[model samples]
Target: MIAAGLGCRKGTSAETLLSALAAACAEANISRESVSVLATGEIKRHEPGMIELAERLHLPLHILDEAALKQVETRTRTVSKHSLAQTATPSLSEAAALAAAGEASELIVARLIADGATCALARSKDHS
Candidate 1:
């Protein structure tokens, strides 16, 4: 992952956001069956279909405080098979953080998805 791969505005819709995440994951060659997702705000605060969509994807959901997300790192170990160009975005780290933190809104996530990205569900490693 690079830095800030996940970039979004503030307050996007749920469907769009999920699509971006899915695209990011696909780009990374990561299977949805293998990763968990972190969401900001309370369960009730999310969109109506979010929970159900997550469940269908078989992704575990972890809730985080948006402020807590600012401290997290998005970049993971680099893949030898990939170069900077292959990544979904210029900043894999930021993208990873957004995927994990949901700092940006659904609309932003959707845009990235439309632009072609593989988004994944991530949680902060800081959690036990």
Candidate 2:
């Protein structure tokens, strides 16, 4: 399964978030339809943009708490200094996607920063 992890400002628009995800998909040469789920830190559970993104894609949004993210942060390909301070993880999007995709998942696309958001893609080898 393909999972996308996201990091965005509290009031970020869904369109902006989608644009970031699209860029990640393009970089990975994968269609958005291949994404089976969306992941983000639990701190964003109330973010409407994230809810909208998940709804629009018809995929589950898995909100991983800081603990879960921390568990997999080391697996991320890059670090976001801002994210590190905010969530105690190097890359929120990368760590989130890796955490939600399961133990055997690997990053297919590193974090792609956009205007007000960031995104990364991961695929579960167990499913692939």
Q: Which stretches of candidate 1 lie over 4 Å from their true place?
A: 1-18, 41-44, 73-111, 115-128
Estimate the lDDT of model 1.
0.40
Error at 95, model 2, angstroms: 0.6
Runs in model 2 with CA error above 4 Å?
A: none
Supply candidate 2's per-residue lDDT for 118: 98
Model 2, backbone clash pairs (residues 3+ apart or across chains), number: 0
User: Model 2, 14: alpha-carbon shift in Å?
Assistant: 0.5
What overall lDDT, based on C-alpha atoms, would model 2 receive against the true structure?
Answer: 0.92
Q: On residues 1-128, what C-alpha lDDT tens digit does candidate 1 reach at each position? A: 11113322234444655666667556655654444453433322454444555566665544434444333333333321221343333333343445554433221222133332223344433441
lDDT of each: 0.40, 0.92
Give candidate 1's error at residue 50 in angstroms: 1.9
Worst ten in a row by lDDT for model 2: 79-88
**TM-score to true structure, per model:** 0.43, 0.97
